[model samples]
Each structure stands twice: as structure tokens, then as C-alpha cells.
Target: MNPISIVLVRPRDPNNIGACARAMGNFGLSDLRVVDPYEPVWRESVSAVGVNDIMQQAKRCATLDEALQDTAFSMASTAIKNREIKQEIVPLPSLNERLQVAPEGRVALVFGNEKSGLSGEDIERCDVVLNIPTASKQPSINLAQAVILTCYELSRRPGFKAIRHPGQAPEAPTDAQKEIFISSADVLFEKSGFKTDFSSDQRKALLRHMLSRQGLSREQLFFLKKWADKLSSKLP
Candidate 1:
């Protein structure tokens, strides 16, 4: 099974998406998820060249959550260092080590559109954030180039292996499960009249970060959802 998944969010250029697929194919990686692409003609992109099979098999998703529904661990690719919300930033060179500690499941490397890297809200949805170090002369790398470099790193990394803990640890919750737990918590928050200065979006972002950083297991997620339901019932 392919351990890594490539996710492109809101890509504005069809050529870039095609090129990314080509890059993944070069590294023997085929799982591709395009989330809310801006252009609809990506399927016919000429840059895909001989790697049409990867493009043909790409999955189209309406949202990041859908793209990440089955992924247990996700990394948001961003060039921006400073942000409103804080997330653990992992540099490209150190990615192998980071992956070694990640939960045992399919991993996602999420990339935003060419115009903008990942937004604060998007980064919050991921387990961690990663960036390629480049010279100050040109800070932002091309979207396809970034994917190429990332794939190259993973392909060449010596002794790289996905983490496995067998029966000792429960499976990590999928993004879909995380969303369900978050939605239940949001309902409980609303019904309980939980007042805070942060906007609902910001609050959700923070909540997402909290859940991601902990690497909560599926059992923990179900327990939290149950707790939220019970507490919500008592509130109103």
C-alpha cells in the first residue's frame, strides 16, 4: 500500500495539478486527492505528459475534510512562517524523522493553490505544517516544484518506514471521525452558551489544533463524542 497521499487544495492552475501527479508517479506514489480545484480543465492538462494514469485515477473532493477522510496523519505545506494560529512546523529535511513518529496510517501531504500557500484555517486542519527552505531572493517556490522536492525527499530518504504499533495502540482517528467529534463538541458548546471572544471559525481552528496535536486515538474520539452528547443533553 502507498503510505503517502498527495492533496492539492484549491489549485488555480490545471498544469500544476498535472505536474504534481507526474511528480508523484516518478516516486511510485499514486494516491492523489484534489480538493476544490479552481479550474475544471485539470483533467486535460498537457503537463501531465506520459503520466496520465495518475491523473486519471485522481480523486476529486469538495473539501479538505473529504480529501483527508481516510488519512490518519496530515501535513500542511506552507511557505509562510508567521501565522495567527500556531502549529508545529516541520522542515522538509527533517520530514523523515517526523514521519517515523506519526500514527500508523496513510499520510497526507497537503498543498494549497499557486496563488496562496495554506491558510490558517487549512493548516489548523493538519497534524503539522512543513516548508521548504529557500533563499530569501525568492521565498515562494512554484507549486509543482514544491511537490517535486517533497517527493524527491521521501523517495531518497534512507531506511524510511511507516510507523507500526500493532495491537498495542488503537488506530488513529480518521479526519472524518475527528470532524464528527468536533461537530458534537460544537453543538455542546452552542447549547451550553459557551461565550468566548474568539469567532466561531477561530474557535474551531483552535479546537482542531488541540485535537491534531494530541494524536487522539479512535477510542478517545468516540469517548469524547459520547461525552459531548451526554453533556449537551443536560445543558438544554
Candidate 2:
């Protein structure tokens, strides 16, 4: 399997850290990286009670960039959207699709602080932003739960050929491919008369769910974009 790291940035609660460590261990992920945690409270004895081994192996870094230095790809989990940052904001399942293909790279899944999720600057450093689909009224999710869900999604194989060897890597979609698909899908939805009065949060949730279900490939994205363009030209 590919090496995966679960990164927590400036987490406030030791209990949440402990729970997150357990989740990573349960899902066969061994790497745990902490970036400037509020306190050095994640000792093996206290924080990771049941999963001491995982904690013992966890790495602590002074900064986010330091923790992510060795990673080939990184995804930031954020609840808010920042138009200034150019990184693609994708649904959770898109991460799953990428993992299904390139399961051998050094991939890092980063989560921000409990009170405030990733900032635009923090998110900009990542290759993609993963947003969990949730209701508009209650879109916020617990930190530990978010880590568990993301880990679970990346661990599952979506009909990809199993690679038993260490060096064998699957071919996952690139960031560009994912962005094109999302942009095309958005255009199609607009041309199809979908209402835009919905809050941006709600619209993002709907788009996340729809794109996740479809799992459009690169070729499919191109076709959809072309079709949407043709239809858009003929519309009154």
C-alpha cells in the first residue's frame, strides 16, 4: 500500500488527537504528523491510550510546510471556500478516486484547527481542498470524525487492480483532470436551469454529491464540457 500521513495542524484538544490516532491505526495508516499543536500533550501514555504504538511513532513538526515536505501530494480539509486560492475544491470521493489509482505515493491528508478550519493561505499550499458533503444548516463536522471519514474513503479500492508489491503504483487522476470535470459539471448545471439562489455552501454540497456519484473520467469531462458549450450557444 502507499504511504499515507494524517496531519493535524494546531489541534486544541488532546482527546481529539488521541481519537484521530486510533482511527489512523485502525485503517492501517501509521504516519501521524502534528504541526504546532497548542500543547505537547500527545504523549504515548496519555493521548494515545489504547494506541500507544501509533503515538510513539508520530512525528511533531514546528510548521505545516516542514511536516508536508516529503509528501508528493497533499489535500487540505476545509469547510470554507476561498476564491483567492486557486487550488481545486473537491468532494471527499474525488480523493478516494485519486487514491484508488495512485496508492503508492507519499500522500498527506491535512486537517486544520478545530475552531477555524484551514485558512486560505494554508489551503493554497495544498494541491487540492476536500470538502465533506453536509447539510447547509449543520455543515460543521467534528475534527476527529472528519479524519476518520477521509481515511476510510482513501483506504477503499474502487474496482482497481490490486497491487500486492511495494513499488507497484496505481494511476490516479491528476489535479487538473479533477478541476476540469468539476468546472464542466458546474457549467452543465447552470445551463440546465438549476437555481443559483441556493447559498454557496448548499450549492457546493450538491455539486460534491453529484460529481462524487458520477466519478467522471478525463475523457468524460471533455465530452461534457463540449456538450454544454454546444447547448449553451443555442439557448435563448
Candidate 3:
């Protein structure tokens, strides 16, 4: 019953959408947002066994931003391995805890197309990335499968014991702050002559994501700034 919305972006299969709806129903969740869907999500979601009413009430959006306009923050689900990810990877339990006290009133969980998971652009829109562990040989799973796993964890949220994340860690950085931090770091790395053929934005995003997941306190932020300044002095 927490203010969590599941946002599906350009889901290719209507059947998967229906399955996701059913999964949502199982967890007593009804909020659904579909962004740039390839097909009529409501019509396709009619296949949802016991969640027909949810399907009828689902929100369809023309773009991801529109879908998440009311969302306080977003969590992107990624199944690919070893790839550079832009958002911080969080375990299901940690996500559950964070959502319970998330900034703003609501949160959105983003899932990408079945053929391909969320892209860099799609991930950039999210505050964090969640990776569901699976067999190393077969990391990728069906879209519905991923939905069910996440929903299952969500369903058991009330029973989860909350762990007080202490230390001077801040209560997670806002999207804007995260962006600024990463951008600043990128500039410092550039001045340091750190060169990489890899996508620079993605790399910076990953750094931001990691820091955000762990939560950055004022002390940590200041420390990073000092480090950047030190690195800057050594450059040229």
C-alpha cells in the first residue's frame, strides 16, 4: 500500500504486461504506468487473470517523464551483467526500506523492453538501478519474470526488519544533486588527464549511482570535493 508505482517503458509484449498486472495484484499493488508502450497496454492487460480492474485503471503515458511526473524518484531494473550501469544497484530489501521513507510522496520502479533492458537514456531518468541476482550463465530473464520477483519482494516488505543505516550518510541524494556530483567529478577526471574510450557519461553516471546507493552525507560530499581539488592541483 506504499506509494510505489511500477512503470513499464515500451514493453513489447502485451502478455507480459498482463502478467505484470497479475503480479502487482498479488502484492496488493495497483498503480501501473506504461510509457511509450508498443501496443495498447489496457487492452493487452485484459489478459490479467484477477487484475482486470487494475488493468482498466492503469495509466498510459506518451513518454517516460510523463509517466514519472508525480514520482518522487525512480528505480531502474537491469539484468545485464558487467555492463557499465548509470544508476546505483540496490538489493530488493534495501530498496524496500528506502521506498518506505522516500522523498516526495511516491516512487516509481522502471522496467524496460523485453528484447533489451533499459538503455543509458532510460537509466539516466532513474535515481537508482536494482539488479536481481540470477545464475551467472543466464542473467537475463523474461520481463514478467523480473516483475514477479520484484513484486514478491515488495509483498513481503511489511515483514522485513528495518536496519538503521547510520553514520553521517545523507538520506540519499536528489536526482539533481547526483547529476551535479557526477558532472563535477567528470570535469576533475578530465583535468587529471584520465582518458577512456568508454562512454564518459556512463562512467560518471555509474560513479554517481554508486555513491547515491550508499547515500552521501555532507561530510562525504566535502571529502570528495577536497579530493577533486587535490587532483586538480596535480593536473598540468
Report the number of the highest-TM-score candidate.
Answer: 1
lDDT (CA) per prediction: 0.87, 0.75, 0.79
**Stretches of candidate 3 above 4 Å error?**
159-236
TM-score of 3: 0.63
Backbone clashes per model, in order?
0, 1, 0
Top-scoring candidate (lDDT): 1
Model 1, 107: alpha-carbon shift in Å?
0.2
TM-score of each: 0.65, 0.62, 0.63
Query: What's the distance in Å from true for residue 17, model 2?
Result: 0.7
Q: Could you tell which candidate, 1 or 2, scores higher by lDDT?
A: 1
Residue-wise C-alpha lDDT for candidate 3, range 1-236, written one tens digit per residue: 34779999998888889999888887767898888778753455556998888788889899998998887878988875867775577876676776776686787889998998888888888888887888899988788888889988886777543233346535554677666667778878788777787578778867876886776775577677677767777788
Instruction: Spell out the clash pairs found in candidate 1.
Output: none
lDDT of 1 by residue, 1-236 (tens): 33999999999999999999988877767889999988888888999977898898899999999999999999998876456647788999998878888999999999989997887889999989888898867778899999999998897666544332246766899988888888888888899898999776787788899998998889988999999999999986
By TM-score, how accurate is candidate 2?
0.62
Q: How many backbone clashes does candidate 2 have?
A: 1
Which regions of candidate 2 fall more than 4 Å away from where they truly are? 44-49, 81-85, 100-104, 158-236
Q: For candidate 2, lDDT tens digit of each residue in 113-210?
A: 88987777788888887788887777778999999898778667454332233673444445566556556656656777877777545665676666
Alpha-carbon RMSD of each model: 24.0, 20.8, 22.6
